[model samples]
Target chain A: MSRVLSIVTGANRGFGSSICQEFVKFSPNKEQHLDFILFARSADSLKNTKESIKTLSKVANVIEEYGVEMSDIPQVEKTFKDCLDKIEWNKYSKICLVNNHGTLYNLDKIDTFTDFQHIQKNNDINITSFVTISSLFLRKVKALPNFKDLEVTMVNITSLAAIKPFESWGLYCSSKAFREMFSNVIAEENKSSPNFKVLNYSPGPLDTDMQKEVRETCSSEETRQFYLELKKNNNLVAPGDSARALAKLVFTYEFTTGQHIDYYDIKEK
Target chain B: MSRVLSIVTGANRGFGSSICQEFVKFSPNKEQHLDFILFARSADSLKNTKESIKTLSKVANVIEEYGVEMSDIPQVEKTFKDCLDKIEWNKYSKICLVNNHGTLYNLDKIDTFTDFQHIQKNNDINITSFVTISSLFLRKVKALPNFKDLEVTMVNITSLAAIKPFESWGLYCSSKAFREMFSNVIAEENKSSPNFKVLNYSPGPLDTDMQKEVRETCSSEETRQFYLELKKNNNLVAPGDSARALAKLVFTYEFTTGQHIDYYDIKEK
Candidate 1:
């Protein structure tokens, strides 16, 4: 049977966990099996996620999990290299990388920020780490012999902040915008490579811990009010629903390269 | 007579020096005198720029220059605060800040990059410092008791990279995109105040040292070809001409707030 390699970051909880769960539920087939590599800050969370995936997939796929601190640049780089080393590239007919890990500092006014470290940490986790991880993954994928014969998809999990700027989200919003454009440029650069695709995926507001933190701890009145209203109106999408939709979009071959796909965009597709 | 504070970063040479020289040449009027604050890393280069400005305008404006490394976050913040402390806010009828300082690391393919620090430095000089400097400036400006009565303009010098990504320019391109979005957000947030304006100014390709570096050092065949073609065709705009045009756009009252103005955009307006 042909194998497929799939990697997701922040795989311990929320959208990341749900994404892995849905992928396992939907991707099992008689002709193909998955080799999963998951990343999170805690090994235990990743193990839990792996167990959940195993429960969904039965005995269909192999699973591996790693604890990686996104802010520790060297560790993140080493973990990526280690994962690539262990993957049996020739056995896999397809590979996918989903960048779902990101961090948001306390929602505070940009002007009132007391420490520059917070800004650095925000960019490091949200944007810099994304660049580093993607670069490493792309390098390895491009080096594969007979690479064009295998399918490859790299999905950058973006948010509405990528296009719209929120009041207290100056760093977070700007970093997401950086990723959006970076994804576009990468797509353009690799246009001749038919097997490779890049998608700027905006999953929309989900009932994730990230959103819950915003509703509870956001100091900006305007931002707090907006999230609170979303909850009151039951407007937030469940993580599982969004993940199922996202997994389907990831597997579909009809989407254009370097396209920005949101929940609605994928739904229409 | 009313005073106008004009601050320009990366003012040692290139477009920055030209911008200062052009500002002095154009802004001599009976109603106002400019107090120029020029920033760059080299004290000697800033002194040269100040001397050039003096030669351009006989005795029309007060000139000051400071050697500032944009990569140094603490120094950047301290210098901004010190400048604000010394400024007689009530004396100036208008104030303008031109963020012209940006660094492009030696052009290299993103995948082959061996040093992560280079990427960190690129984003720091291009986007993070811009945010820090602008936040400090805005906080001080808004604190003025009669902030609405005083005219303020924050001009961020962007490039074609802000919208279009160039080959071998991944870090440079993404950083400018971050600044572009950040500028847009700030404009939206300050919409209630009419006296404040933010311009994400795209200066276009100019006959400057940075372009010279691109023509000489760029390793990517596609990028070198594009820039070399511009030079051969004499399509690169002269720094003085672009600076003069940009200064005119900055002084205009008809421009909308939070607008992304390019050389062509302003020419049409």
Candidate 2:
């Protein structure tokens, strides 16, 4: 049985976990099953998640997971390399790597927040690690004997914070913006590659932990009320919707790669 | 007599030190007298530079100096506070801050060069610390009742890298871009304030140690030839020219506040 390799970061919960679930459901060819590589910080939290996935999982291929903090700078190469060691390279012809992990730091008053620890944490996961992991695996994919047929996709989860000045979303927004520009260059440089697909995805107004913190800290009463109303209207998107959108993007990877793919755009598509 | 107060960051060498020299040379009553404050990482460097200034330095006003590393996040705040602690607040009405520091990281393969020690160094001084210091000082100016007549101008020294993507200058370019955007917001938010001025300035391509390193690093014959041609053709700018250009921008600070003022744009003015 040939293996289809898929790696999802921040896969313990939220959109990352949701992405993995859809990969199991919509992934083509059960006979050429995908070996799911779930990367996250918490293994215990995933124990409960595994039970739910067991019920919904449609693909017969086995799930191989990595319990490591992608944000931890020193461990990234070692951890990701270990997973690659286990994979049977010949079995996989396509690699879909989704980087859904993100860290949002609260820093409206620069003087009040000069904590390097917080800055280091945000920079590591949100910007540097994405580049590091993508570059590492990209070289590997290119070196593979199945390189000609392989579609090496790198999808980065990004935000609207780049365009709008969201209060206290400094670290998060800057990181997202960097990712967008980074992916743009990658796409341009690899224009001729038939199977090389790199995408920057804006997940769009999710009712997630990061958003919850934003609502609490924002100084503007009007902005806070607007978000609260937005959530109440169920105007906020669900992780499942993003997951489905991503799955669709991958299946139609030919059309969506290289540009920034927003969840809002998927609705129109 | 009121003291003329100013602070210059990255004053250890090059345009940073030259900027400090220009400030000291601006004759009291030429516009207004200023008691200057100099900031850099080396106390010894400032001491030697101080000798040249003592002759023309304001007779009655004092020039206080400090050593502070911008990378130490908390240390910037402490350094600024230490400066503030020494100054008799009642003596000075006008505040001028110059963010004139930049750094380059190891240039190598874009995909493989994952070591970010140099990137972080640049961010600490050029981007993060600049914002932190400016944000704090702006609020202070707003908070003080005596500062009603005070005009506080923050000048961020940006580079060509802010707009262009030079292969070897990834981290430096990204940080400058970040600084430009940061100052843009500060300007927009302070649109109503006549006294608060946030400015971004590119000093042009000067023959600083940084530039010299860039020239030396292009050891390849093809690339070195291109740079040699650029320099010979009068394309390269000198440090003195950049310093003089910035002085004019500061002289016309009231007119150009909250906007980009490039040394390259000297002709139009």
Candidate 3:
């Protein structure tokens, strides 16, 4: 039989693909088992990713669902609904959902490239879709009888960008900050649900294309200098390193489900 | 000249009407300097309100912009922008904008209501439009070279319902909470503005029709009980009293902006 499925969005490259690799390492084979229902907007990206990770585990059922952006609520809702229909809730004791996909919105030059549409898109994809999808997920799990005993862990992979907003990243920062509060409310809502854990994490800076893109896009001389300074101080962590650390937290961290787990918080705990 | 052209949305009843009355108390002059525009969606409601508020000393600009709903962003954006355009910002020292009109999303059973569009609508009006309009106001004042010296005050008439969300009030409560944070961010942005003060206030339960309507809806047992407790304890302040308290804050409490001002906070300060 197929191993219990784990779904990861934006798994073409960067943080998302790293998360999938780590999930493979910690597939919860002790009680039951786990596989991956990989999700990304680009099938070509997913295809390349599938090839790279193919040798990792032949038994690992990498069910790929590409071309779904988290911001597009209708597509996400339908895709996940189909995935739910296909999956066996009884086989999996827990559905560890990693919301790692995010669209970066940087208004470098207010006059040049500052289209507020980017902000709206960021709000839709990064924040609103996460919430809408989560609501759908809750409805799905609530429908299952055996899964009634299991808690659903929702790990929102947020960034330092949420709080420490830069000048150009106005929209992206605001949406992420708002999303943090939204998730906090969600956690509060699930207080009665013992099996529900919603974790908002600030994974330390990773050497990714997103980071480089942001660096290139930022217009403020002071802010650009600050980024350089931060980088020179060796502040950025590798995605793979961060992934392993996150994997450890997911597997070993025996805390309640609905806490905002930042890197400092996790280390402190 | 009109006593600082003041615009209040949803002014037909509840907190909006009360806001109109209270604004007059702290005008530049009792006779001539007062322009209070009352806006609502319904023609009947607007006319009835116009008749009630019409007086010699204080001129009420009864605008038939139709009833503005917080949930509909496009309608709100257009209506609010149109209403804003007619007013000359130079005539008024302080354009006191009190967004007191709001509607709670509730139902006997949620499925009867359809989708989260209503919830989306509530946020659009109460949160998104509130912020958007405030931004427009800031831009308006900033555009004029002379108005730069004058003070502008924004008081968002919020409810205790937002602080502690109840069943059936998911959208209303969360939207208010979200708006507060959004307000804070905006406040931080406008800190450098020579004359700007923003405050989010929970006008202790007013004896408005909305309160009675809330009581009548009676969907969630918990919210019903809470309302009863407030009414029993005389915690519910009359709209006039609430409005007076808010007006005083707008004029005299310009020092205290960017904070979530509660009824108790006013008393304490």
For B131-165, candidate 1 gives per-residue lDDT tens digits of 88888888888989978888899998988887887
Error of 2 at A111 (Å): 5.8
Task: Note the DockQ of each predicted structure.
Answer: 0.59, 0.29, 0.21
To one decimal place, how large is model 1's interface RMSD in Å? 1.6
What docking grade does candidate 3 earn? incorrect
lDDT of 2 by residue, A200-233 (tens): 7788888776668767886546567878898888
TM-score for the B chain of model 2: 0.87
TM-score per prediction, in order, is: 0.96, 0.85, 0.84
Collision pairs in model 2 = B4-B34, B4-B35
Point out the higher-scoring one by lDDT: 2 or 3: 2
For model 1 chain B, where is the 10-residue window of minimal lDDT? B56-65
* CA lDDT of each prediction against the hidden true structure: 0.81, 0.68, 0.64
Q: Rank the candidates by lDDT, best first.
A: 1, 2, 3
The model with the greatest DockQ is 1
Error of 3 at B166 (Å): 5.3
Instruction: Output the TM-score of candidate 2.
Output: 0.85
iRMSD in angstroms, per model: 1.6, 3.3, 4.9
lDDT of 2: 0.68
Is model 1 an incorrect, acceptable, medium or high docking prediction? medium
Instruction: Estimate how well candidate 1 is docked, as a DockQ score.
Output: 0.59
lDDT of 1 by residue, A208-259 (tens): 8999899988878888999999988999988888888877876766688988
